[model samples]
Target: MKSILNRRNVALSGGPSRLLAVAHDAATQRTAAASDAAAHDPHAASASGSPADSVVEIESRAEPAAGATLPGEGASGPRPVSTLHAVPVMPAHLNGRPVQIADGAAFEALRAADELTTFRVYRCFAYTVSLFFHPPTLGYFVALHQESVLWRALKANDLDAAGSAFHLMQEQATRLADGETRRAQLVAQNAELARLIEESETQAERLRVDLQRHSEQEQTVTGRQHQVRKEVAQLEAQRIAAQAQLNKAHRALHQLKVATSEGVPHLHAR
Candidate 1:
């Protein structure tokens, strides 16, 4: 067995350091190249200058070197790194947005506002067994989350702090989900209220139309009544005039009869 294949390294450090992840796709090519190189060059079979059994280098620096390939990264080149307070934990993207990690009062604001990520990079170690045969394409596999003390603890290998951050993340996720559900409920309620208002307005419009129709009918009936009363009054006046004419004729006939009778008696006496 090749000593390179047989041996492996796990790295840890106290205090503060940054975590760099290996890219998955380029990981396979590096080992195969080493194996091919050994097969071609007899001198390369010694494995003296070979990488230190996939050991990740941990060292103190104020900030990570830009575009620096992690030791043993080979063709994968420099690993990408982000800043965390003292201990480093990169952030993950959620809902297509990269989570932001702010330090000091800004991070406090995120904690108070509850707009932070829950994911943490607790451990960055080779999965072993399989790494000897078939290493994952990416050399370093870890996590990213924003503005978490728990993340720093995880980086420093603090088990208790990591656990606390895990629980807090779960709670925040629950709260956000509940808030979204409540908003949906309120929207449905508003729609229902608007529908009811529209129905009431429609009913009111129908009532107004009926009232107007009734008013027009009442006006027609009132006009008809006035016409009928006027006709009655005119008829009554004609009837009174006819009565007066009849009385005048009756008086004339009575006077003429009396005059004829007196004249006939006078003739007889003569």
Candidate 2:
């Protein structure tokens, strides 16, 4: 029963240093008690094992053996402290800092004041403070957590402190959310700009290709025009030479006819 009590205490503390100290003390006490019994009767030493063995047994009971777990714990380890209490033993951080929240009546007052404020920010994150009114303590217990991890908690009879903490956490959470939103917007805008730049570059490249093709076409058309002009000049020269030869033939025919008429006697036109 005493060993069981020691084990319960060790489990409740859940600190390795504390467990070691408690185990050592229990072992020393058991060793002294065993030594006393053994001195009283020499046969008692043989009946019960050595004092060293008793001490070892006490120490073992005081602390779980390596790789062993307490009742209700898995082989991995004991459950987190938050599971047993309203808040974590060590709170997790957000952006390298923990958020503070107020509990109970203070939380209600802050919420009411927030509604009246013109610039209201929405709660975009899952962090929140929960409150429970304790009849026995006549106080409010405030817990800040997201999922299974509790970030901060307090019990306050003074509602103002709890309210201040709750609103502060709310503000911190909103600021983080707004920052994330801005970052996302910037990233999207940059991506859109990059896409536009790539599209413009592609269009410019296509225009360059079209310009090159049109230049080649113009060069081919200019060469064809030059060749056509040369052919037209040659045709014009040939037509002029043909006309001169025909005129010479006509003149010769006229001279021959006149000579024949003069040689023969000719009657005047009557």
Candidate 3:
């Protein structure tokens, strides 16, 4: 019993508590058998000395049996490492449709399987579905996956069922992809609209600046025109005064000529 407990404790999978339970059960059974044997043999208890001593001897004898290897284990040391194979408990078809993988073993096997073909959808979001043909079982498996985890799976034994399952998964993926494509397009359109709005605002600002500069030029021209009008008025008044003074000087010269002619007229008249 001690040897069995020690061996079980050394197992890679089951922990020490399991070993303890197994040891306790084995010890009880051996004790009960020894007690029966002793009760049948009137002198057996005397021969064994005590119940504890008998138990010790039975455990020692059981050590060799405990050491013997179970199926798939080696003759000595730890049990051999082996891969788990999922037994197919699900029916091949249910109501003329390929059955989904709900069995624990089948689901695990699907996770460990390598993909024969895969398709990814949803653009930025990574959603995937894959097809795999398990050579051992000669069946097809399809799975819906995201990251490292599989969300759902289907199993099929023949090509017709496999095709149906594949198409079903493909349809689901395509529907999701359609929504993602629309979302991507909407984002792109929004970005483009924002760019156009920015450009329009920039152009409007430039036009505003140009209009302000043109207004300043108009104001400068108006100020210069006012100064030019003032100069024109002053020049007009000066020209009028100069013209009047010249006309008066001319009239005075004519009058003096007339008086001189009057004084000298008698000789020519005669």
As for model 2, its CA RMSD to the true structure in angstroms is 19.1
Minimal lDDT window, size 10, model 1 = 125-134
lDDT of 3 by residue, 71-108 (tens): 44344547567999998784657448666574545666
Taking the tens digit of each residue's C-alpha lDDT, what string does model 1 give over 1-270?
Answer: 232222211212222112332311223445566677888985875654552233322112111432343354535655458775786665644333333332345434544565444434222121110000002221111222333332321121233433444444445444545666688789999999999999999999999999999999899999999999999999999999999999999999999999888867445555
RMSD of each: 24.5, 19.1, 17.1
Candidate 1, residue 2: Cα displacement in angstroms equals 64
Task: Look at candidate 3 and give me any clashing residue pairs.
Answer: none
- Candidate 2 wrong stretches, greater than 4 Å: 1-170, 249-270
Distance from true location, Cα of 148 in model 1, Å: 28
Against the reference, the lDDT scores of all candidates come to: 0.46, 0.62, 0.67
1 or 2, greater by TM-score:
2
Ranking by lDDT: 3, 2, 1
Give the poorly placed runs of model 3, Cα more than 4 Å off.
Answer: 1-124, 134-138, 174-185, 238-270
TM-score of model number 3:
0.45
